[model samples]
Target: MFNPSQFHETVQRINTKVPDVQHKASQIDIASVKLANEWFIPEPVARLIIWLKDELIKLVEELMNMMTQVMEGIEAPITMWEDAYKWETVRGIATSVAADVNPSSLGSTGQWTGDAATAYTNAIGPQSTAAAQLATIADSTASSLRSCAEAGLAFYIAVALVVAQFIAAEITAAAGDASVVAAPAGLAAGLAAAATAVGVFVGLVAAIGTLIGTEASQVSTLHGLAVDSTAFPSGRWPVATNI
Candidate 1:
């Protein structure tokens, strides 16, 4: 007998998980923007970076819902099957978005894994043409993510350089002023500006790195859920395998 209390608890847990996921996703977008502004990335590229981060976060949420269905054992095989279908649907959308961003790297290997990979492979069959197609899409998405990160870094560096130049000019101008004392004020101001630029640059870089790590972890979690949700030898059975 499925305990209603248990089901409620599970739902609550999922709810809790979602906000954390959303927070991280938002952080990724903010970081991307900061980095882009620093590096002077074009408006279009910055917007695209935000879009990619949001989309990935959305996909993760969908995957989590599907996983919950599998855990709840709502209707045994049929419900479980539906859950798998939903996962595939979300993946399809992700892949489509990735293809739109970068097609050449479509289906490149080693970028995604776990539930997404398994669901995709199962949907198209491991050796089928469809699987190959999905692989390409996954590869493209990963590559696009990497490209976005690089663009962010470049933007940050460019801004830092500009700020540094401005500070240098200010210092030189102050040096020629008769009223300007040889005290440490000018030097201190210059140092402060440079320090601020370095701090911003480092923060952006860290954010990009964190986003990548989070994505990888989420992929792994999804995969593990997909694998553990069903009983293998029984062939896609979702009756709480342990019971």
Candidate 2:
């Protein structure tokens, strides 16, 4: 389950990582500047440097934008579910109530059947069953909320992985041998390959209930979960014991 507390900690770590990535991007820019001043760089090599630098910075900017949506649409809702709704607490209370009026707790010893005991059992039996049903509902609702949070986290992770792939490609191109002029073409190819893999993986994640997807059905699912709260009204039916 995706605990809101753990997600908060994970988001803090991700926040720290953003600054580190920004710093690395700045260093890349500085290195490119120094190389331009010192070396007899060919046109192709200089263009490659500029292209890779721009692409890296673009990925970082996109990541930041995605983080905003993640916090608003994903983390916020999960936190609300954890704090405001308190489904797990409700489940605990219901479970305890369901178990409290059992034969053992009601002082019904072995073969000790009396009028009072029978009357108590008759009164409590349906209530216990109803409480158990409510407990199950609460547990499932909590699980669903966690699943939504996890789905959003997965999309955010997919974006981060794409950024990492770009960084790796940039570093490789900058540090390679004399055939570095061909780096731009290789990097473009690398970008296409990385996009393909991430696209497929993200598509699967969206299919399994996530916020990232290109298809219509997946997008609809994302909208329903993240945006359309009215579509999923909680506690629609009144609570009542099975009579």
Candidate 3:
């Protein structure tokens, strides 16, 4: 079940983290640029220093790009909060209404007879069915939203790994000649990590799409029921025919 309180708490937690993440990314980007600009290389080592500096700066830029994607993922749940609440509220109302109109709730009209009793029985059945259908719609919508929120959080975690790789590349660049031999290996590791994260994020996005489609189909069914119910004078549905 999607608990609204839990969702709100998660959003609040992410809200507190946004500024810190952005600040760290910005600082790294600026520092990398400064190091690239100020490093002095003698003629003998100029080629190596220039190449390393350019590579470091490039890695820093990619770090910022990864940070951007992570931040977007973090923000997704906050934006979705409204929609989640809407569905949750609908679910609560529908469930309550369904219970109210159910046979057990309405009870038997054993003491009554004629058109009045017949009408009550017929109306209760269809009304209960329609209310149950509405509840199902809400449940489906909530489930889809839950999947999306979970996926977005997972995506952020995955991309953060990619960002860490760039940071490692920057550290290796700053280590100077003693670590120069390790630079290629560090860069390769960073690229490999990025590929893995992007692949996972793509898969998560596709799964979210499928969940949304299912939610839409459930909602469409409820809409159809509402339209069909319009024919009855009582305006209740799945129609009274089942009665």
| Per-prediction TM-score | 0.30, 0.52, 0.60
Give me the runs in candidate 3 sitting further than 4 Å from their true place.
1-45, 78-86, 177-243
Backbone collision tally, model 1: 9
TM-score of 2: 0.52
lDDT of 3 by residue, 1-243 (tens): 434565555555545544443454344445434443444534434444445445444544544564465556566654555676788899899889889878767656666689878887766766677777777767777766666665555544544444444444344434333344443344344344434544554565566557656655766765664555533235444554444
Lowest lDDT 10-residue stretch of candidate 3 = 175-184
Q: Which residue pairs collide in model 3, if any?
A: none
lDDT (C-alpha) at residue 59 in model 3: 43
- lDDT per residue (tens digit) for residues 1-243 in model 2: 455665565566656555665575566566655554446777667776567656655655654564455445545545634642588898899899889955556665446679765666666765566566667666766665655556655554554555455455445434432244554554455445434544554464456443322322443443444332232225232223334
For candidate 2, give the lDDT. 0.55
Clashing pairs in 1: 38-155, 39-155, 39-156, 106-136, 107-135, 107-136, 107-137, 114-223, 115-223
lDDT of all the models against the reference? 0.42, 0.55, 0.55
RMSD of 1: 24.0
In terms of TM-score, the best-performing candidate is: 3
